[model samples]
Target: MDGLLLRTNYSDITEFILVGFSRRPHVQAAFFSGLLCLYLVTFLGNSLIVIVIQRDPQLHTPMYFFLSNLSFLDICYSTSWEPYVLTQCFKNFPTISYTRCYALMTTSLFLGMTECLLLAVMAYDRFVAISNPLRYTVIMNNQVCLQMAVGTWVSAFFISIVPIVAIPANFCGHNIINHFTCEIQAMLKLVCSDTSMSLILGLVISTFTLPLPFTFILISYIRIVAAVLRIRSTEARLKAFSTCGSHLTVVTIFYGTAIYMYVKPQSKESQDQDKVISIFYGAVTPMLNPLIYTLRNKDVKGALRKLIGGKEKS
Candidate 1:
């Protein structure tokens, strides 16, 4: 059959050409500079949060524990691709080895999925804290928090790998990827075989990763808001809102862009749009997370100040 012949003759793609931003020198230069700066900020900000939380005994609570994990995830997530993307800016035709491409894709997917579940867990933490202040410690004990964290990472890995495993090795023969990184949807566009199964599998996995966790977050917030409203004191209500506002902002920025990117139909016309949106959740949100939490949180800020004072006194 002709199909058999086509399959037999298929070229084993050794590498993939990443067609990143505009080929213009000016555009590449600007984007490289902007992305480099963003990466640095993201690294430093998240790193600082982790270090501060680890050193501060006051911050050993369930909330900061989750935040530290989030920071670590952001560091790993961005590092998986940003350096490659930066180097590609200098090349006329940027290429990634086939094995490395898949590795990066799998890593990013696992981390992204972990973050989604982690965020939902964090929302649940907030709900427990605000709704049952007295029982919060008992409910979210060290063992429970550790189990949740472990479960999030483990579940995300399984979820991330399933769709990847489903994709036939020879599904894509094309060597050119039109996006910056080895994003699944972008790679899907290059498939030489029928993509219906791949797309369906991706949709099912994405539902569990994105929408399901997102819905849990929304429900958790609804309950949190209801609990806060029942508080009689204006000061208590303001305090509750203040504690949650940063997490809510982060969830919105991350999940909003993510939902848009993954949940929507991927089209040829939307590749550029996809890149732009990816930059938000991928780079911008990570950089902003530390700033948002620190600026809004008195406890984190106080701990930061105390750390600085201790260093200065030494």
Candidate 2:
């Protein structure tokens, strides 16, 4: 495929130029300020979560274990493009170097994959807790939790390397990415080589990564609902259901927008629509996750309490 599509020399494609959002002054400025604040919150929120989880031994459970990993992945996932996007607010045409593009690809791929896996693991944890409440403690032991977290990271890293190999070698003579980040789809579009494999590979990866996790999440919730209904205690059932509400909402938003953006082919109208969704997933989702999922969590609240007390005492 590489040899066949070599229209011109290969060495000319040295950088990937990103044509960011338009030159509208008010829009640019507004976006700049808004994204800057979000990025700051993302860094601070995730950092705080990790610190609290570490310092507060009470949070060393399976749920918080995955949640902390999720937060870390969200930070990496957002930073893969958010800072670059913020920086591009004033530039007439902000260009990301080829190496930077590759770096973004690698980081985004790994982080995105990690987030997906984390969601899956979280689903399993929910399933175990809800479906087998009596044995949840035994099932979600420290060793098992560590294995799940480590396994998720390793799987994501392994799968992400394929694109790094393919993209750099086949990007023959053009390197213009339309979005702020080095997107997998946008980068694939720039490649001069046969994209059949890339497209297929993308479809395959997206299928394996998203649908199964979502299915497990759906199953976990369905079982949770059944368990809740069987409960004679109304208040207990409602309280039990509340535990999954935030996570389910997050899963819906993340997977729904992601599928709409990439799984289905985009018309020109849809492409314009997709840019907004992409921004949501890449930037907005990370910002929302901490606020919605962790901040609202009672255990996290307790950890924060402990942290504040420790600081005041010292």
Candidate 3:
């Protein structure tokens, strides 16, 4: 196994061919148009959220502070690879250089891991707000929120590096990736080296990044529900549930698709399904987040109205 794995020289490989979608011209044109629309919507929607949060004094609390960060993450997340994907859609043979491929992979993983941790932090914020309303501000103060945001980014950066380092460096000349971007599983399939160790490391890292944070969010929500239940006023209970509904929706869409994508075993048969799922979490979710939050939350709706009104007045 060792000899066979070592047979291929990785240095000889300079680029990877991304076998993204249907080669038919009509199919490619439709895919391109669709992705372009998704990218535009994601960018504008998340940007609006960030702008609204920054300009609104009422949204300066810990919850909105975290939301601003999330919006920024979504913007960066969508921007990082969507352009490349869009460009690749029309290409007869889409190719990404080795360095560029790795860079995109690492960046995507870092942003995604940041999102996972940030969502967990947001859950904790909701938990504190619902569970200890009196001390919510005191507990999740400006300094603490800043620290949590910084810590989430820094931790995700390092965590994203782990799997990249663990992956076998040698590749057998098979450089075709079946996905649009440099998705980890798709890239891993191209490696000629023995991948058992890499697979194990990827699983362990996936557990840390996915299940642990998801479990934390689940536990936090459970407590939040318990606290909400204890509230005597029916109206108050409704408000509490309303506050969390957007976050829960976002969490369910994001983590549900992500956990399914990363945690499950990947096979050739699933590559097409994987691409569609990736679009849901990657493109559609970001596009939908602002809509979900704004439409569902009164405060955000008010802020958006004020922002639009102010702009119109100006």
How far out, in Å, is residue 270 in model 1? 5.9
**lDDT value, candidate 1, whole model:** 0.82
Per-model TM values vs. the true structure: 0.93, 0.89, 0.93
Which structure is stronger by lDDT: 1 or 3? Answer: 3
Tens-digit lDDT string for candidate 2 (65-87): 88888888888888777887787
Question: Candidate 3: which pairs clash?
Answer: none
Which candidate achieves the best lDDT against the true structure? 3
CA RMSD (A), model 2: 4.0
| lDDT for each residue of candidate 3 in 243-292, tens digit (9 for 90 to 100) | 89889999999989999988887554426778888888788888888888
User: In what order do the candidates fall by lDDT, top score first?
Assistant: 3, 1, 2
How well does candidate 3 score on lDDT at residue 240? Answer: 90
Provide the overall lDDT of each model, using Cα atoms, as 2-decimal numbers.
Answer: 0.82, 0.72, 0.83
How high is the lDDT of residue 16 in model 3?
86
